[model samples]
Target: MNWKGVLDFLKEKKFGLDRKELVEAETSPVVPDDFCAEEVVYEMNDMGEREAIERFVPPTRSTATRKPPARTKGHSRGSMVDPRTNRAITFASAHEWRCALILLASPEIAEVYDQPPAITYVDAEGKKVKHTPDYLAVSRSGKKCAIAVKPSRRVEKSGIVDTLDRIKPILGDYADDIILLTELQLTHERATNAESALQAHSCRVQADCDRVAVIMSGINGEVNAYDVAKAFGDFPRGMNAIWCLVYDGIVKLANPALMLADHPFVFRVLQATSVAA
Candidate 1:
Protein backbone atom coordinates (compact mmCIF):
# COMPACT_ATOMS: atom_id res chain seq x y z
CA MET A 1 0.00 0.00 0.00
CA ASN A 2 1.15 3.55 -0.65
CA TRP A 3 1.28 4.91 2.92
CA LYS A 4 1.96 8.52 1.84
CA GLY A 5 -0.81 8.29 -0.77
CA VAL A 6 -3.28 6.97 1.85
CA LEU A 7 -2.42 9.69 4.43
CA ASP A 8 -2.62 12.39 1.76
CA PHE A 9 -6.00 11.16 0.59
CA LEU A 10 -7.32 10.97 4.16
CA LYS A 11 -6.14 14.49 4.93
CA GLU A 12 -7.68 15.82 1.70
CA LYS A 13 -11.08 14.18 2.08
CA LYS A 14 -11.09 14.60 5.90
CA PHE A 15 -13.34 11.51 6.36
CA GLY A 16 -13.63 7.79 5.55
CA LEU A 17 -11.16 5.67 3.55
CA ASP A 18 -10.14 6.56 0.00
CA ARG A 19 -11.68 4.79 -3.04
CA LYS A 20 -8.75 2.32 -3.34
CA GLU A 21 -8.91 1.23 0.35
CA LEU A 22 -12.72 1.01 0.32
CA VAL A 23 -12.67 -1.23 -2.81
CA GLU A 24 -9.96 -3.46 -1.23
CA ALA A 25 -11.64 -3.77 2.20
CA GLU A 26 -15.10 -4.68 0.81
CA THR A 27 -13.95 -7.15 -1.79
CA SER A 28 -16.14 -10.30 -1.40
CA PRO A 29 -17.42 -9.27 2.05
CA VAL A 30 -20.42 -11.29 3.17
CA VAL A 31 -23.72 -9.43 2.90
CA PRO A 32 -26.33 -9.94 5.66
CA ASP A 33 -29.89 -10.83 4.69
CA ASP A 34 -32.44 -7.97 4.76
CA PHE A 35 -34.12 -9.18 7.92
CA CYS A 36 -35.94 -6.00 9.06
CA ALA A 37 -35.94 -4.05 5.80
CA GLU A 38 -39.61 -4.80 5.10
CA GLU A 39 -42.42 -4.22 7.58
CA VAL A 40 -43.27 -7.44 9.47
CA VAL A 41 -46.50 -8.54 11.15
CA TYR A 42 -46.77 -11.00 14.02
CA GLU A 43 -49.70 -13.40 14.18
CA MET A 44 -51.61 -13.76 17.44
CA ASN A 45 -53.72 -16.89 17.79
CA ASP A 46 -55.74 -16.26 20.96
CA MET A 47 -56.17 -12.48 20.68
CA GLY A 48 -57.11 -12.74 16.99
CA GLU A 49 -55.27 -9.50 16.19
CA ARG A 50 -51.94 -8.73 14.44
CA GLU A 51 -49.28 -6.83 16.38
CA ALA A 52 -48.84 -3.29 15.13
CA ILE A 53 -45.39 -2.14 13.96
CA GLU A 54 -44.20 1.29 15.03
CA ARG A 55 -42.41 3.53 12.56
CA PHE A 56 -40.13 6.43 13.43
CA VAL A 57 -41.78 9.77 12.86
CA PRO A 58 -40.96 13.16 14.36
CA PRO A 59 -43.65 14.54 16.61
CA THR A 60 -45.29 17.89 15.89
CA ARG A 61 -43.97 20.76 18.02
CA SER A 62 -45.45 24.14 18.98
CA THR A 63 -44.36 26.91 21.34
CA ALA A 64 -45.62 30.40 20.58
CA THR A 65 -49.30 30.38 19.65
CA ARG A 66 -49.39 33.56 17.55
CA LYS A 67 -46.93 34.67 14.87
CA PRO A 68 -46.16 38.24 13.88
CA PRO A 69 -48.20 39.60 11.01
CA ALA A 70 -46.69 39.72 7.52
CA ARG A 71 -44.85 42.91 6.62
CA THR A 72 -46.72 45.26 4.37
CA LYS A 73 -45.14 47.87 2.07
CA GLY A 74 -44.80 50.44 4.84
CA HIS A 75 -44.30 48.10 7.79
CA SER A 76 -41.19 46.55 9.34
CA ARG A 77 -40.38 43.11 10.76
CA GLY A 78 -37.57 41.76 12.94
CA SER A 79 -36.69 39.34 15.73
CA MET A 80 -34.62 39.39 18.92
CA VAL A 81 -33.74 36.68 21.43
CA ASP A 82 -34.85 37.54 24.98
CA PRO A 83 -31.95 36.82 27.32
CA ARG A 84 -34.16 36.37 30.40
CA THR A 85 -36.07 33.37 28.99
CA ASN A 86 -33.78 32.51 26.08
CA ARG A 87 -36.71 32.69 23.66
CA ALA A 88 -36.85 34.24 20.22
CA ILE A 89 -39.56 36.93 19.84
CA THR A 90 -40.69 38.18 16.47
CA PHE A 91 -41.90 41.76 15.98
CA ALA A 92 -44.11 42.92 13.14
CA SER A 93 -43.01 46.53 13.43
CA ALA A 94 -40.17 48.60 14.81
CA HIS A 95 -42.40 49.90 17.61
CA GLU A 96 -43.04 46.39 18.86
CA TRP A 97 -39.32 45.58 18.78
CA ARG A 98 -38.57 48.66 20.82
CA CYS A 99 -41.28 47.73 23.31
CA ALA A 100 -39.83 44.22 23.73
CA LEU A 101 -36.34 45.53 24.50
CA ILE A 102 -37.65 48.08 26.98
CA LEU A 103 -39.69 45.42 28.75
CA LEU A 104 -36.76 43.00 28.86
CA ALA A 105 -34.54 45.69 30.41
CA SER A 106 -36.86 46.33 33.34
CA PRO A 107 -35.78 44.76 36.62
CA GLU A 108 -39.37 43.95 37.58
CA ILE A 109 -40.16 42.14 34.32
CA ALA A 110 -39.47 38.41 34.49
CA GLU A 111 -40.64 37.16 31.09
CA VAL A 112 -41.87 38.61 27.80
CA TYR A 113 -44.23 36.93 25.31
CA ASP A 114 -44.62 38.47 21.88
CA GLN A 115 -47.80 38.20 19.85
CA PRO A 116 -49.61 36.50 22.68
CA PRO A 117 -52.95 34.73 22.25
CA ALA A 118 -55.84 36.92 21.19
CA ILE A 119 -58.48 37.99 23.69
CA THR A 120 -62.13 38.64 22.82
CA TYR A 121 -63.59 41.82 24.26
CA VAL A 122 -66.51 44.10 23.51
CA ASP A 123 -65.71 47.58 22.25
CA ALA A 124 -67.62 50.81 22.90
CA GLU A 125 -69.77 49.95 19.85
CA GLY A 126 -71.32 47.02 21.78
CA LYS A 127 -69.88 44.37 19.43
CA LYS A 128 -67.62 41.44 20.22
CA VAL A 129 -64.08 41.90 18.95
CA LYS A 130 -61.01 39.73 18.95
CA HIS A 131 -57.88 41.74 19.68
CA THR A 132 -54.28 40.58 19.88
CA PRO A 133 -51.83 42.49 22.02
CA ASP A 134 -48.32 43.26 20.87
CA TYR A 135 -46.64 41.69 23.90
CA LEU A 136 -47.43 40.24 27.30
CA ALA A 137 -45.04 40.73 30.22
CA VAL A 138 -44.88 38.80 33.46
CA SER A 139 -43.50 40.58 36.49
CA ARG A 140 -41.35 39.19 39.28
CA SER A 141 -44.42 39.41 41.51
CA GLY A 142 -46.32 37.13 39.06
CA LYS A 143 -48.54 39.89 37.66
CA LYS A 144 -49.27 39.81 33.92
CA CYS A 145 -49.60 42.94 31.73
CA ALA A 146 -50.73 43.15 28.13
CA ILE A 147 -48.98 45.87 26.11
CA ALA A 148 -50.06 47.56 22.90
CA VAL A 149 -47.45 49.45 20.87
CA LYS A 150 -48.47 52.00 18.26
CA PRO A 151 -47.43 55.33 16.83
CA SER A 152 -49.05 58.40 18.37
CA ARG A 153 -50.31 59.52 14.98
CA ARG A 154 -51.89 56.16 14.24
CA VAL A 155 -53.37 55.91 17.70
CA GLU A 156 -55.35 59.11 17.05
CA LYS A 157 -56.11 58.31 13.41
CA SER A 158 -57.33 54.73 14.04
CA GLY A 159 -58.91 55.42 17.48
CA ILE A 160 -56.65 52.78 19.12
CA VAL A 161 -57.13 54.55 22.45
CA ASP A 162 -60.88 53.82 22.47
CA THR A 163 -60.21 50.17 21.72
CA LEU A 164 -57.58 50.06 24.47
CA ASP A 165 -59.97 51.77 26.83
CA ARG A 166 -62.56 49.09 26.22
CA ILE A 167 -59.99 46.29 26.51
CA LYS A 168 -58.72 47.70 29.81
CA PRO A 169 -61.94 46.82 31.66
CA ILE A 170 -61.81 43.07 30.95
CA LEU A 171 -58.01 42.82 30.85
CA GLY A 172 -58.10 41.73 34.50
CA ASP A 173 -59.31 38.35 33.23
CA TYR A 174 -56.06 37.73 31.32
CA ALA A 175 -53.73 40.41 32.67
CA ASP A 176 -53.55 42.71 35.65
CA ASP A 177 -53.42 45.77 33.42
CA ILE A 178 -53.29 46.92 29.81
CA ILE A 179 -50.64 49.48 28.83
CA LEU A 180 -50.47 51.47 25.62
CA LEU A 181 -46.92 52.42 24.61
CA THR A 182 -46.17 55.04 22.00
CA GLU A 183 -43.03 56.37 20.31
CA LEU A 184 -42.96 59.17 22.84
CA GLN A 185 -42.31 56.69 25.62
CA LEU A 186 -39.83 54.65 23.58
CA THR A 187 -37.11 57.27 23.39
CA HIS A 188 -33.72 56.80 21.76
CA GLU A 189 -31.98 56.90 25.13
CA ARG A 190 -34.16 54.13 26.52
CA ALA A 191 -33.67 51.99 23.45
CA THR A 192 -29.89 52.42 23.71
CA ASN A 193 -29.84 51.65 27.40
CA ALA A 194 -32.06 48.59 26.96
CA GLU A 195 -29.69 47.26 24.31
CA SER A 196 -26.78 47.85 26.66
CA ALA A 197 -28.55 45.99 29.48
CA LEU A 198 -29.14 42.99 27.22
CA GLN A 199 -25.49 42.94 26.17
CA ALA A 200 -24.30 43.33 29.78
CA HIS A 201 -26.52 40.46 30.87
CA SER A 202 -24.85 38.10 28.40
CA CYS A 203 -21.29 38.70 29.75
CA ARG A 204 -22.08 39.12 33.47
CA VAL A 205 -19.60 37.78 36.02
CA GLN A 206 -20.51 37.02 39.64
CA ALA A 207 -17.26 38.40 40.95
CA ASP A 208 -17.91 41.76 39.33
CA CYS A 209 -21.42 41.84 40.75
CA ASP A 210 -20.09 41.17 44.24
CA ARG A 211 -17.58 43.94 43.87
CA VAL A 212 -20.27 46.37 42.75
CA ALA A 213 -22.46 45.29 45.62
CA VAL A 214 -19.67 46.04 48.07
CA ILE A 215 -19.23 49.48 46.58
CA MET A 216 -22.97 50.18 46.71
CA SER A 217 -23.05 49.19 50.38
CA GLY A 218 -21.07 52.31 51.21
CA ILE A 219 -23.45 54.53 49.24
CA ASN A 220 -26.27 56.29 51.08
CA GLY A 221 -27.96 58.88 48.88
CA GLU A 222 -28.58 59.09 45.13
CA VAL A 223 -25.57 58.87 42.80
CA ASN A 224 -24.79 59.06 39.15
CA ALA A 225 -24.21 55.79 37.35
CA TYR A 226 -20.96 57.13 35.86
CA ASP A 227 -19.66 57.95 39.32
CA VAL A 228 -20.57 54.49 40.53
CA ALA A 229 -18.73 52.99 37.60
CA LYS A 230 -15.72 55.17 38.37
CA ALA A 231 -15.72 53.93 41.95
CA PHE A 232 -14.93 50.42 40.71
CA GLY A 233 -11.75 51.77 38.98
CA ASP A 234 -12.55 49.61 35.92
CA PHE A 235 -15.08 51.40 33.77
CA PRO A 236 -16.19 48.62 31.41
CA ARG A 237 -16.52 45.88 34.00
CA GLY A 238 -18.00 48.29 36.53
CA MET A 239 -20.70 49.52 34.14
CA ASN A 240 -21.60 45.99 33.21
CA ALA A 241 -21.85 45.10 36.89
CA ILE A 242 -24.07 48.11 37.51
CA TRP A 243 -26.44 47.03 34.79
CA CYS A 244 -26.55 43.53 36.26
CA LEU A 245 -27.32 45.08 39.63
CA VAL A 246 -30.10 47.10 38.04
CA TYR A 247 -31.63 43.93 36.62
CA ASP A 248 -31.33 42.27 40.05
CA GLY A 249 -33.19 45.23 41.67
CA ILE A 250 -30.23 46.22 43.81
CA VAL A 251 -29.87 49.39 41.77
CA LYS A 252 -32.74 51.53 40.49
CA LEU A 253 -33.11 54.66 38.47
CA ALA A 254 -33.96 57.72 40.57
CA ASN A 255 -36.76 58.84 38.26
CA PRO A 256 -38.33 58.18 34.89
CA ALA A 257 -35.31 58.91 32.78
CA LEU A 258 -32.71 57.30 30.56
CA MET A 259 -30.67 54.53 32.20
CA LEU A 260 -27.29 55.51 30.83
CA ALA A 261 -24.23 55.24 33.06
CA ASP A 262 -24.32 59.03 33.45
CA HIS A 263 -27.92 58.98 34.66
CA PRO A 264 -28.86 59.29 38.33
CA PHE A 265 -29.86 56.22 40.35
CA VAL A 266 -30.51 55.29 43.94
CA PHE A 267 -29.22 52.12 45.52
CA ARG A 268 -31.97 49.95 46.99
CA VAL A 269 -30.41 49.30 50.39
CA LEU A 270 -33.25 47.10 51.60
CA GLN A 271 -32.89 44.65 48.71
CA ALA A 272 -29.12 44.48 49.16
CA THR A 273 -28.56 40.78 49.40
CA SER A 274 -24.88 39.79 49.25
CA VAL A 275 -23.77 38.26 45.96
CA ALA A 276 -20.53 36.97 47.45
CA ALA A 277 -19.30 33.50 48.33
Candidate 2:
Protein backbone atom coordinates (compact mmCIF):
# COMPACT_ATOMS: atom_id res chain seq x y z
CA MET A 1 0.00 0.00 0.00
CA ASN A 2 3.02 2.34 -0.55
CA TRP A 3 1.21 4.62 -3.04
CA LYS A 4 3.85 7.44 -2.85
CA GLY A 5 6.68 5.00 -3.82
CA VAL A 6 4.56 3.57 -6.64
CA LEU A 7 3.82 7.08 -8.11
CA ASP A 8 7.53 8.12 -7.95
CA PHE A 9 8.59 4.84 -9.63
CA LEU A 10 6.03 5.39 -12.41
CA LYS A 11 7.12 9.03 -12.95
CA GLU A 12 10.88 8.11 -13.05
CA LYS A 13 10.24 5.17 -15.41
CA LYS A 14 7.99 7.28 -17.71
CA PHE A 15 10.51 10.13 -17.98
CA GLY A 16 13.71 7.93 -17.84
CA LEU A 17 15.17 10.13 -15.11
CA ASP A 18 15.77 9.83 -11.34
CA ARG A 19 15.31 12.68 -8.72
CA LYS A 20 19.11 13.71 -8.99
CA GLU A 21 18.88 14.31 -12.76
CA LEU A 22 15.62 16.28 -12.33
CA VAL A 23 17.14 18.44 -9.53
CA GLU A 24 20.28 19.15 -11.62
CA ALA A 25 18.20 20.12 -14.66
CA GLU A 26 16.09 22.51 -12.55
CA THR A 27 19.12 24.36 -11.01
CA SER A 28 19.46 28.09 -11.78
CA PRO A 29 22.44 29.48 -13.76
CA VAL A 30 25.09 31.61 -12.01
CA VAL A 31 25.36 35.36 -12.83
CA PRO A 32 28.67 37.12 -13.53
CA ASP A 33 29.66 40.50 -11.98
CA ASP A 34 29.79 42.04 -15.51
CA PHE A 35 26.14 41.04 -16.05
CA CYS A 36 24.88 43.07 -13.04
CA ALA A 37 21.78 45.25 -13.68
CA GLU A 38 22.73 48.34 -15.66
CA GLU A 39 22.52 51.57 -13.68
CA VAL A 40 19.20 53.35 -14.37
CA VAL A 41 19.80 56.60 -16.23
CA TYR A 42 17.20 59.13 -15.02
CA GLU A 43 18.27 62.41 -16.64
CA MET A 44 19.47 63.07 -20.17
CA ASN A 45 20.96 66.51 -20.72
CA ASP A 46 20.78 65.83 -24.48
CA MET A 47 19.10 67.99 -27.12
CA GLY A 48 17.17 64.95 -28.50
CA GLU A 49 14.69 64.86 -25.59
CA ARG A 50 14.21 68.65 -25.70
CA GLU A 51 13.61 68.60 -29.46
CA ALA A 52 11.03 65.78 -29.19
CA ILE A 53 9.10 67.46 -26.34
CA GLU A 54 9.10 70.79 -28.13
CA ARG A 55 7.84 69.14 -31.29
CA PHE A 56 4.92 67.44 -29.51
CA VAL A 57 3.86 70.11 -26.99
CA PRO A 58 1.38 72.78 -28.03
CA PRO A 59 2.99 75.97 -29.24
CA THR A 60 2.35 79.27 -27.45
CA ARG A 61 1.32 80.91 -30.78
CA SER A 62 -1.64 78.48 -31.09
CA THR A 63 -3.86 80.97 -29.20
CA ALA A 64 -2.48 84.09 -30.87
CA THR A 65 -4.89 84.01 -33.81
CA ARG A 66 -8.28 82.55 -34.72
CA LYS A 67 -9.52 82.96 -38.29
CA PRO A 68 -11.89 80.96 -40.49
CA PRO A 69 -10.92 79.90 -43.98
CA ALA A 70 -12.23 81.95 -46.91
CA ARG A 71 -15.37 80.38 -48.35
CA THR A 72 -15.15 79.18 -51.92
CA LYS A 73 -17.79 80.61 -54.25
CA GLY A 74 -18.75 77.36 -56.07
CA HIS A 75 -18.02 74.70 -53.46
CA SER A 76 -20.72 72.11 -53.09
CA ARG A 77 -22.10 72.22 -49.56
CA GLY A 78 -24.87 70.58 -47.55
CA SER A 79 -26.23 70.90 -44.05
CA MET A 80 -27.89 68.49 -41.63
CA VAL A 81 -29.05 68.73 -38.03
CA ASP A 82 -27.11 66.45 -35.70
CA PRO A 83 -29.46 64.23 -33.65
CA ARG A 84 -27.07 64.07 -30.73
CA THR A 85 -26.14 67.77 -30.55
CA ASN A 86 -29.28 69.27 -32.11
CA ARG A 87 -26.99 71.60 -34.05
CA ALA A 88 -26.94 72.27 -37.78
CA ILE A 89 -23.74 70.76 -39.19
CA THR A 90 -22.52 71.78 -42.62
CA PHE A 91 -20.33 69.61 -44.85
CA ALA A 92 -18.58 70.79 -47.99
CA SER A 93 -18.36 67.32 -49.55
CA ALA A 94 -20.10 63.95 -49.57
CA HIS A 95 -17.13 62.43 -47.75
CA GLU A 96 -17.51 64.97 -44.97
CA TRP A 97 -21.21 64.23 -44.67
CA ARG A 98 -20.59 60.49 -44.37
CA CYS A 99 -17.96 61.10 -41.69
CA ALA A 100 -20.35 63.39 -39.87
CA LEU A 101 -23.05 60.73 -39.90
CA ILE A 102 -20.61 58.20 -38.43
CA LEU A 103 -19.71 60.63 -35.66
CA LEU A 104 -23.35 61.49 -35.02
CA ALA A 105 -24.27 57.85 -34.48
CA SER A 106 -21.29 57.01 -32.27
CA PRO A 107 -22.09 56.41 -28.60
CA GLU A 108 -18.57 57.53 -27.64
CA ILE A 109 -19.14 60.94 -29.17
CA ALA A 110 -21.04 63.30 -26.87
CA GLU A 111 -21.06 66.46 -29.00
CA VAL A 112 -19.85 67.38 -32.48
CA TYR A 113 -19.22 70.80 -34.02
CA ASP A 114 -18.49 71.63 -37.63
CA GLN A 115 -15.45 73.85 -38.33
CA PRO A 116 -14.98 74.94 -34.73
CA PRO A 117 -11.76 76.86 -35.41
CA ALA A 118 -8.89 77.14 -37.84
CA ILE A 119 -5.54 75.68 -36.76
CA THR A 120 -2.44 77.66 -37.75
CA TYR A 121 1.01 76.19 -38.28
CA VAL A 122 4.25 76.66 -40.22
CA ASP A 123 5.02 74.03 -42.84
CA ALA A 124 8.34 72.38 -43.69
CA GLU A 125 9.07 75.32 -45.99
CA GLY A 126 8.47 77.78 -43.08
CA LYS A 127 5.33 79.21 -44.66
CA LYS A 128 2.45 80.13 -42.36
CA VAL A 129 -0.56 77.94 -43.13
CA LYS A 130 -4.08 78.01 -41.76
CA HIS A 131 -6.17 74.82 -41.85
CA THR A 132 -9.75 74.26 -40.77
CA PRO A 133 -10.68 70.79 -39.61
CA ASP A 134 -13.99 69.25 -40.73
CA TYR A 135 -15.33 68.58 -37.25
CA LEU A 136 -14.44 68.87 -33.59
CA ALA A 137 -15.78 66.25 -31.18
CA VAL A 138 -16.10 66.02 -27.43
CA SER A 139 -16.23 62.40 -26.36
CA ARG A 140 -18.24 60.96 -23.47
CA SER A 141 -14.87 60.47 -21.76
CA GLY A 142 -14.38 64.29 -21.93
CA LYS A 143 -11.50 63.99 -24.43
CA LYS A 144 -11.48 66.60 -27.22
CA CYS A 145 -10.67 65.53 -30.80
CA ALA A 146 -10.48 67.27 -34.14
CA ILE A 147 -11.40 65.32 -37.29
CA ALA A 148 -10.62 65.92 -40.97
CA VAL A 149 -12.46 63.83 -43.53
CA LYS A 150 -11.00 63.42 -47.00
CA PRO A 151 -11.02 60.88 -49.80
CA SER A 152 -8.15 58.40 -49.86
CA ARG A 153 -6.91 59.76 -53.17
CA ARG A 154 -6.78 63.34 -51.87
CA VAL A 155 -5.35 62.45 -48.46
CA GLU A 156 -1.79 62.65 -49.80
CA LYS A 157 -2.36 65.23 -52.54
CA SER A 158 -4.11 67.54 -50.07
CA GLY A 159 -1.18 67.23 -47.65
CA ILE A 160 -3.64 66.14 -44.95
CA VAL A 161 -0.94 64.17 -43.13
CA ASP A 162 1.52 67.09 -43.12
CA THR A 163 -1.27 69.48 -42.18
CA LEU A 164 -2.32 67.29 -39.26
CA ASP A 165 1.31 66.82 -38.19
CA ARG A 166 2.23 70.51 -38.31
CA ILE A 167 -1.01 71.68 -36.72
CA LYS A 168 -1.18 68.89 -34.12
CA PRO A 169 1.12 70.77 -31.72
CA ILE A 170 -1.09 73.83 -32.06
CA LEU A 171 -4.36 71.92 -32.09
CA GLY A 172 -3.20 70.03 -28.98
CA ASP A 173 -3.77 73.24 -27.05
CA TYR A 174 -7.51 73.00 -27.73
CA ALA A 175 -8.00 69.29 -28.40
CA ASP A 176 -6.53 66.19 -26.83
CA ASP A 177 -5.80 64.72 -30.29
CA ILE A 178 -6.15 65.30 -34.03
CA ILE A 179 -7.41 62.59 -36.40
CA LEU A 180 -7.47 62.35 -40.19
CA LEU A 181 -10.18 60.00 -41.48
CA THR A 182 -10.58 58.79 -45.05
CA GLU A 183 -13.93 58.03 -46.69
CA LEU A 184 -12.88 54.41 -46.92
CA GLN A 185 -12.93 54.04 -43.12
CA LEU A 186 -16.24 55.83 -42.51
CA THR A 187 -18.41 54.52 -45.36
CA HIS A 188 -18.97 50.91 -44.25
CA GLU A 189 -21.67 48.51 -43.09
CA ARG A 190 -21.20 49.76 -39.51
CA ALA A 191 -22.15 53.23 -40.62
CA THR A 192 -25.29 51.85 -42.25
CA ASN A 193 -26.17 50.00 -39.07
CA ALA A 194 -25.60 53.16 -37.05
CA GLU A 195 -27.89 55.04 -39.41
CA SER A 196 -30.57 52.38 -38.89
CA ALA A 197 -30.08 52.58 -35.12
CA LEU A 198 -30.39 56.35 -35.23
CA GLN A 199 -33.68 55.99 -37.10
CA ALA A 200 -34.96 53.61 -34.42
CA HIS A 201 -33.84 55.97 -31.61
CA SER A 202 -37.32 57.45 -31.34
CA CYS A 203 -38.97 54.09 -30.59
CA ARG A 204 -38.22 54.24 -26.87
CA VAL A 205 -41.22 53.51 -24.61
CA GLN A 206 -41.69 54.26 -20.91
CA ALA A 207 -41.75 50.52 -20.12
CA ASP A 208 -38.61 49.78 -22.16
CA CYS A 209 -36.32 50.50 -19.23
CA ASP A 210 -38.01 47.97 -16.93
CA ARG A 211 -38.30 45.38 -19.70
CA VAL A 212 -34.67 45.71 -20.73
CA ALA A 213 -33.53 45.48 -17.12
CA VAL A 214 -35.53 42.26 -16.62
CA ILE A 215 -34.22 40.69 -19.81
CA MET A 216 -30.61 41.65 -19.00
CA SER A 217 -30.97 40.31 -15.46
CA GLY A 218 -32.47 37.09 -16.73
CA ILE A 219 -29.65 36.52 -19.23
CA ASN A 220 -27.03 37.57 -16.62
CA GLY A 221 -24.73 39.19 -19.21
CA GLU A 222 -25.29 38.33 -22.89
CA VAL A 223 -28.52 37.65 -24.81
CA ASN A 224 -29.46 37.01 -28.42
CA ALA A 225 -31.66 39.51 -30.26
CA TYR A 226 -34.37 36.88 -30.88
CA ASP A 227 -34.60 36.01 -27.18
CA VAL A 228 -34.82 39.71 -26.35
CA ALA A 229 -37.54 40.14 -28.99
CA LYS A 230 -39.43 37.14 -27.60
CA ALA A 231 -39.45 38.69 -24.14
CA PHE A 232 -41.36 41.75 -25.42
CA GLY A 233 -43.91 39.65 -27.41
CA ASP A 234 -43.58 41.96 -30.45
CA PHE A 235 -40.48 41.49 -32.60
CA PRO A 236 -40.37 44.88 -34.31
CA ARG A 237 -41.18 46.84 -31.18
CA GLY A 238 -38.67 44.82 -29.16
CA MET A 239 -35.95 45.23 -31.78
CA ASN A 240 -36.65 48.94 -32.01
CA ALA A 241 -36.44 49.23 -28.23
CA ILE A 242 -33.10 47.40 -28.27
CA TRP A 243 -31.76 49.72 -30.95
CA CYS A 244 -33.03 52.68 -28.97
CA LEU A 245 -31.22 51.44 -25.88
CA VAL A 246 -28.03 51.07 -27.97
CA TYR A 247 -28.49 54.55 -29.42
CA ASP A 248 -28.92 55.92 -25.91
CA GLY A 249 -25.79 54.06 -24.64
CA ILE A 250 -27.88 51.88 -22.30
CA VAL A 251 -26.98 48.65 -24.10
CA LYS A 252 -24.06 47.78 -26.36
CA LEU A 253 -23.66 45.18 -29.11
CA ALA A 254 -21.47 42.32 -27.93
CA ASN A 255 -19.58 42.21 -31.23
CA PRO A 256 -19.46 45.70 -32.71
CA ALA A 257 -17.19 44.40 -35.47
CA LEU A 258 -20.17 42.44 -36.84
CA MET A 259 -23.03 44.31 -38.52
CA LEU A 260 -26.44 44.48 -36.83
CA ALA A 261 -27.87 42.69 -39.87
CA ASP A 262 -26.03 39.56 -38.72
CA HIS A 263 -28.62 37.12 -37.40
CA PRO A 264 -28.87 36.41 -33.69
CA PHE A 265 -27.30 39.74 -32.74
CA VAL A 266 -25.69 39.63 -29.31
CA PHE A 267 -26.03 42.51 -26.82
CA ARG A 268 -24.97 43.36 -23.30
CA VAL A 269 -26.38 45.96 -20.92
CA LEU A 270 -23.97 48.88 -20.46
CA GLN A 271 -26.04 50.63 -17.82
CA ALA A 272 -29.57 50.45 -16.39
CA THR A 273 -31.23 53.81 -16.73
CA SER A 274 -34.87 54.91 -16.41
CA VAL A 275 -36.27 55.32 -19.92
CA ALA A 276 -38.40 58.12 -18.43
CA ALA A 277 -35.20 60.09 -18.02
User: Which has the greatest lDDT?
Assistant: 1
lDDT measured at residue 193 in model 1 versus the true structure, 0 to 100:
73
- Give the runs in model 1 whose Cα sits over 4 Å from its true position: 1-64, 124-126, 259-269, 272-277
Q: Could you tally the backbone clashes for each prediction?
A: 0, 0
Instruction: Show the colliding residue pairs in model 1.
Output: none
Best by TM-score: 1
Residue 157 in candidate 2, Cα distance off native in Å: 1.4
Off by over 4 Å in 2: 1-77, 270-277
lDDT of 1 by residue, 190-248 (tens): 87777776667666776777888888878887766656666776656677788777666
lDDT of each: 0.70, 0.64
Worst 10 residues of 2 by lDDT: 55-64
lDDT of 2 by residue, 1-277 (tens): 3997886566545534344544454433323222332334434456545232222221122111233334577445666656554456777776776777777777778877888778778988999978877888888779999988888987778888988888877765689999998866876666776766666663445365447656766565667765676566555556667776777667777766556655345656545442311
